[model samples]
Target: MAATEATKAADDAYDVIVLGAGPTGENLADRAHAAGLSAVIVESELVGGECSYWACIPSKALLRPVTARSEARRVPGLSDAADVALDSSAVLAHRDAFAAYWKDDGQVRWLDSVGIDLVRGQARLAGPRRVVVDGGRVLSARHAVAVCTGSRAVLPNIPGLAQARPWTSRDATSAKKVPGRLVVVGGGVVGVEMATAWRALGASVTLLVRGDGLLPRMEPFAGHLVAESLAEAGVFLRTGVEVREVRREAPGGPVTVVLDSPPGPGGPGGTPSDEIIADELLIATGRAPRTEDLGLETVGLTPGSWLDVDDSCRVKGVTGGWLYGVGDVNHRALLTHQGKYQARIAGAAIAARARGVPILESDRWGAHTATADTLAVPQVVFSDPEAASVGLTAAAAERTGHRIRVVDQDLAAVAGASLYADGYRGRARMVVDLDREVLLGATFVGPGVGELLHSATVAVAGEVPIERLWHAVPAFPTISEVWLRLLEAYRG
Candidate 1:
């Protein structure tokens, strides 16, 4: 809507207003509407946000086929349907289809169907309980206002990187053709994923990590296994390294990166040069919360440009309980699922308060919520053998003063794992809080383990006792049977 119309609409009081129409924002609106409260979601960009358009949905859609084909080749007995191939054109077509070609029509229809008002424009905090739309018109909320602004990929401040040109996760994931040689910076999930994806698509891939291993935040074994997996996939793992500088070199100009260390057997390992060149450079360092230009200072709500929220997702400095924040915008766990969880908790809490229900301060289901984020935040890497993990790491558990018992299992021993391939070498590790008799965290690294994560997620989130989890049966010949083996190993 235009600024005038937006202002006119904003002139009235809304019971709850959610800014950003990503999964978290949408979930917030849905839960609010379900509780019989009036809610509107304001979206400046695509309704489905980064996950739907670029980050998760499209990338996974592209990688799944390549993974399936690779699996079929590795496990010949399971597949009898002759030759398998991924049609590059069809893969791109499917990726576009998954994103609806960036169209918001389906999202709009869903919102209309669910009775949530849809506002299209930039939104910023206009007051303690109000938002300014498109930089002009203002909308005030009666109960709560939420910020679910998500995050943007961050490019590092490396010299000549911008002039030499580099692709962020956004650009690389949406490319039409794979480059001949792709150099990816940062050994986090995105870099590892793109490295494997493009390598499978005929690109020679080199992955650089500032740390000594891939996924440094995960357990050492998990990181080691993943780095090994990537290396086996023909990716050059340049860990514990730095890209000192970048410059365009040659006629067509490949970006030449000056490394901190030379490559040679005696001089430092691979090629004996202080520099390397590649057709494309991809920076997958990480992301920062999108909290700028939101007028956070208007209500004394600024905490170093990020809104400080309590357990209930309420903006800490906003008086009278008016302002709130959720999703990646809160600088909490940046996973999309975690964001949605916070939104639901916040929406429920706000809805109950509007009804004068005398809500509890930290009810498990309240708006000042996000209980799951603390214990059940899960992540899955979409690379060939896919890595999935939830909750705390072993070090994190120990740091928290928990008595921990760790059961780390190799995938090949599990009956279900052997069927995955003849030469399957994967890993699964669980950190159990012995004091609570519950799992504090879990990590699984292997093919087809993506779906297996939710079970562990529920176990950890629900605090399901390891003894009780034994009854959560798995069907025959399924990778899930690894759970039984895991429990057995834990028991032993």
Candidate 2:
């Protein structure tokens, strides 16, 4: 859908103007409309945003088939049938279908149905409650203007890297053809997940990690288990290695990656330090908040810096509280789901403030408070032997000075898990706050553990006590029975 000019006059104003039409921006607009506010959302790209076209949806679509076949191979009778290789073309087609072929017609209709005006253009903060779209249109906001521009993938400054045209998370997820030899740099979520997807799609994957292991933010055991699984799946893992340079002669040519010496203790002395040529190189280093060119300087804020927000998602500085930031721009948990949660809270707060609600109650778990951003953030990486976690890890809890009891359980010991797979290998950990007597965090690593994470998320967010969790029993002959075993281990 092309950017259509609004029929309203040039001086027309809305109660709220949300920048960026990503999921966070869309949710903010919807919530503000629900609160009876005349809202408008400005977007420079597709209405459904990154998760819709590039990151989450397409990547997961590619992964689901691989995961299903792996699960089938683990079962007794299905093993023989599942041994057949995946059809890469079919998988890519399915992924394109899930991404809607990068079209936003459905999302545009959604915005129109909800009565929110969609302005398609790059938007910049002009002044207090003012936004200027790139096409020389000035949008005036009567109540608030939200920044939900989200983030972009950042590649390390390796020599010739930019010229090499290395694939970012976007290209990796949306590639039309899988490369024969894929060298994936960085061992983060995108790196591991993409490597898993492409490798399963018949790419010979070599994963390079600068750190000692993958998933450094997760529990140590989580990375250990995932690394083991990747190795078993024939992904070559190279730890403590850095890509020092990159060179590609032409657009469709192979890429040559140069490596630096491995650092830190126990580094391999004989490891080669140069020249890894591959059909494609994926640089999934990290992401930077998309705040560089929003013209924040027009409002006495720094450009290219993350916007700090209170629980209400209001930008910390710039008096009068007319400016707000949510999602990746605010740097409060960069996951898509968490951004939507913040958008809901921010929208409610915006509505209350617009109505002259004298006191905004932003207490813990309040309607206008984003308590979960700090307390309980749930994430699931859909790799083989999936890693699903919520809240803090045991290390994070201990570092924060919380006296906690850690419980460990082998998922293989669960009767349902053994029956589910011929040789199920996984682990579960629960961190209990001694003083609060509630779950501080939980980590589950294994096949089919992604769905089980919501139970932990609910327990942590609700602050459910240990005693109360006893009555919430898991059904027999299901992988969820691991919860009962975990609780038993904690009790013992």
Which has the greatest TM-score?
A: 2
Per-residue C-alpha lDDT of model 2 across residues 1-492, encoded as one tens digit per residue = 223445345545989999999999999989999999988888989999999999989999999999999999999999999999999999999999999999999888888777788887889988898888884888899999999999999988889999998899999999999899999998889998999999999999999999889998889999999999999999989888878889999998999988885444323455557578899999999888888989999999999889999998999988899999999998889899999999999999999998988545547988899999988999999999899999999989999999999998998888889998989999999999999899999999999999999999999999999999999999998888888987888888
**TM-score for all models, in order of appearance:** 0.92, 0.97
> What C-alpha lDDT do the candidate models reach, one value each?
0.81, 0.90
Number of the top-ranking candidate, with lDDT as the measure: 2
In the predicted model 2, the residue pairs found to clash are: none
Candidate 2: segments with Cα more than 4 A from true spot: 1-7, 263-272, 358-362
Given candidate 2, what's the lDDT at residue 53? 98
Error of 2 at 56 (Å): 0.7
